[model samples]
Target: MWDRLATDGLAILVIMCLIELIVPSRAKGPVMWGFNLVFSLMLFASTLYYAHFGSVPTYTALRELHQVPQIKGSVESLIEPEYFLFFIDLLVLAILWGVTLSKPKSMRLGRRPVWKIGVAAAGVVSLILSGWYIHNGGKIENEIVQAENLGFLDYQVAAVLKENRQNDEITDGNLGKTKSEVKKLQATFAYKDASSGKGNLQYFGAAKGKNLIIIQMEAFQNFPLHLSLNGQELTPVLNKLAAEGLYFPNFYQQIGQGNTSDAEFMSNTSIYPTGTIAMSTGYGDRELPSLPRLLEKYNYESSTFHVNDVSFWDRSKMYPALNFTHYYDKPSYTNDHFNAFGASDEELYRVGVEKLSELHKQNKPFYAQFVTASSHAPFNVPKDRQRITLPDSLQGTELGDYLTAINYTDYAIGTLVERLKQNGMWDDTALVAYGDHFGILPKLASEEFISSELGIKYNDQVSRYNIPLLIHIPGQSSGKVVERVGGQLDILPTVANIMGVSLAKEGFTAFGHDLLNVDHNIFGMRYYLPTGSFFNDDVLFVPGKGFDDGTAISLKTYEPVTDITKYRADYDYILKLMKLSDAYVKQLPKRGP
Candidate 1:
């Protein structure tokens, strides 16, 4: 809780400082100091409470802050001071400082209209922003409250601690401690890295000499598969490859830490997801045993390719932790420029091809991991492709732009496939492509776009988590569609299966199953924010935590199963997964049995 308050306070203070710089204020110092002192005191008090009483009261306070607004249909219902007051306090202090610093008697409202206008504009902006901050904080608090009622607070608290711990100084002891935690974290999952079992590269088929390529496509969604009057087929290349590849149609992703590198860590290392900031931001310095190191035992070269800022998510250190021999980020690419997210997909694919060809020429099989960035928010694609126009339904909205970006990325994939075929590298190489997670369609947009597109009310928990996964094995004409639901965690075992490696028996007992195997039964838990969904063979549970003490009823059946304890157990699993995910990414090895 202090971490949250501290982070928020730091951000607010930074913003206030920046504002002061832009509009020099002499009189505001006293008010700013007073405001800071008050906030500091409040923060200290809260920290004391958290340490003494535990997170229970803090959690309770948070829950109470989210209660349905007393006044119906009031935006005030959305405002929660506890959450947003930290920022408000900063803004208020800054304003008070500015006002106090100003020589009011000498100040002329008309004499210096420019400064007055600037100050007024800044004040308005601050007030609007403060309002929004409060609203979102309240809204999120409500969601947290609901989740807590359903027993997710423990996981939430665990997530808070795990995230904070990662930012601590990276010491050998810390790394060693991380290594110990990995065992408990991985225990929550079923399968172990096959390489962990025998310490023999041959058992995991790393000796088979098959090249591996894992691609994490940003903001890829399943809606594009449905051809509409205005919606262009977004992934023709992947759809075409689906005919020749082993397609896992029912695969899901258990995304953690809302960052691409974190997704890569989870997918590659079979770690669970964390509920906090991007794992890369927090765990970049920790040492851990990752897939790259495990595969290095078989003499395979490993590399990571991200056509974006190398420092965006602290990828500089993370790639090394994963034991990649090389990392090719924006600096390495001198071709086309990137827009909103980063480099154009065309450029990314072209650069990736050149890199792959170079590695192939060396006669050393390599793991070339490429992360796509074009399909991210703002949906900036090259202007050359025909712009995709959505129906009246999505026109002028972010969804329309998002789909257009998807189509652009699909074309880039097509180009990549053609290049591989032309170079004769298509036959022996393997292609694994999966979306990082669902695109961010704001609530209004989700209702207008996703709900309309699917012809189903998108209110339930399960609808948002659906994504696409495609695995293409060169020259292996599987042409098989497997409907068994799986997630990124299952990818390791599935790859091991294809590469002909055996997963550790005890490891498979936790979370992942071999995708190619029919007897495996697995469950998945997914979250986007406060709301979340859990899926198993039996049923897909959409749990609203705060409503009626958490488990309200099946949105589909309206049958009540409000067992707070059950919800708590599920949340504990989520918490466990979050820790495991980070520990794995930091390449910290679990204590072996």
Candidate 2:
């Protein structure tokens, strides 16, 4: 019973409650203890159920809690039916206790009103519990099926610790020879694999190394370009760039590091963001085979530049880890100081133009990375920087603030392109720009507001994951839109493929395919598993696990899948991917400050 209490406090609550009724009704403090235990146990049980067998509501709640510093909304919208059911269960136990104590012989103070209260309480609890059971009968049954396979029920508190602390790795620090110890731990628990492709790894592919410039935009979504107030364009610069470059219509962002830095790391290195810490915060200064490092082998001078504090998210450490030879942070750009956030996007572009000119003087092939910062939380753009105007219908709020930042960034992109043309490198340089992930807009806003701005349903899985990817190679003329499902993880391998570099066989294997080529159809699992989210062309499946309360959403008709077992086989692959990412993340360097 003691062991049971440790493992499941809620189960013990039910037993304790029954025991209290055996005692006389006059036993005041003990009866109060039982009630307190029941309340505490119910809360604990809800948390345990979420930890072990959390369905959609639980998972969503967890994700929302970890949202970036500024976004605000209620987490109640994401809760599943299990939360209500748990309350009903506790209520029923409460009513049952009241009923027996209400007997006249058992309690001289017992009266008709006491009986009345018992009946009302029982009726309410019974109604709620029965309704929930009826509505989610299949889900509850499915959960019971999964529960049958339970082992020690050891809680995985690691995920919670990771979310809160953001820096505790499996190993104490750099594991050294104990790297093997970490590896053993991963193998013992079955960590996920991070790589996905089966082809030969490539390194420096540039026979004639042209300069490379990668722009990872923060919170840049496709919505503003699609927005039309009475058919007026909100984003002219974005529209211009779209026409000038190759836009990937189906490109997706597999969220990493919980924000822009994560997307930048995965896209730049093609490695899963797992283990001790996000590559940005943890591995930036460590040795890693990122775009800069890979390009360095081919005599390409590589540098990373960001329009924010170098210390923000620890990019100062990450840029060096990826082997960038030069790094320019906020202070690097003169006349560009505005917010503490970083240099404005326009100034970052201006500095890029200057740096490109300086690199031209050096007469060396170069790789430069720019991480934008202003479009991040707070979402405010400077008065001079704000280029796009919103109608009266869209003024005075965070959403409007976010829209202005995006427009300003788009304008900055246009200015940079023009700068490239002026420098005569427009024809030779390869330019790649993409959003790190979805913008953290408030979900509580009107659906029409989101749909109008983004050109798609804002809450849809596709909209959540889908962002823009643009690759412009002058004189390539092949501007056709590629509709294959791809992700931020595909960026490194795809760029390597374009540059003709071969990767090391053991060190780096890409989870993404080369989108420039038409051969591979690899798609990434979008969310966590055994019951998370999966993406394919024909359908979008979101299976709720630990219970039958799973959801499968279709992209085409916006249909939800009530019965998810039809795709049970897919869960195997999803779990495999999860293990791989976890394993490799554990393998990442856990260096000290």
TM-score of each: 0.65, 0.66
Displacement of the residue 171 alpha carbon in candidate 1, Å: 13
Q: Please list the residue runs of candidate 1 whose C-alpha ends up more than 4 Å from where it truly belongs after superposition.
A: 1-143, 146-208, 226-232, 453-460, 505-511, 518-527, 530-533, 538-548, 552-593
**Number of backbone clashes in candidate 2:** 28
Q: What is candidate 2's TM-score against the reference?
A: 0.66
Q: Give candidate 2's error at residue 435 in angstroms.
A: 0.6
lDDT per residue as tens, model 2, 127-158:
45433433343332232222222111212222
Quote the positional error of residue 430 for candidate 2 in Å: 0.6
* Cα lDDT tens digits for candidate 1, 1-593: 33234324333544454454454454346545664666565554444333222232333233223222311222222233464444556666677546745756566343365765665566566545544443344332233442233222222443454335654533234544654565565455434444455343322442246788887888776546534443356567788777777676556557743346667877666666544445555555655445676568767888888777676666775776667898888877765655644468778878888888887888878887889887766565566664565677666566666777787877778888888777667776788888887664443265545667746455324444556777787666556777766777777767766665455532332245566654333444534444344544333444443323444334344355555454544545544554444444444543322
Model 1, residue 14: distance off in Å is 22
Q: Which regions of candidate 2 are displaced past 4 Å?
A: 1-208, 230-232, 282-286, 335-340, 452-458, 504-507, 518-531, 546-549, 561-566, 588-593
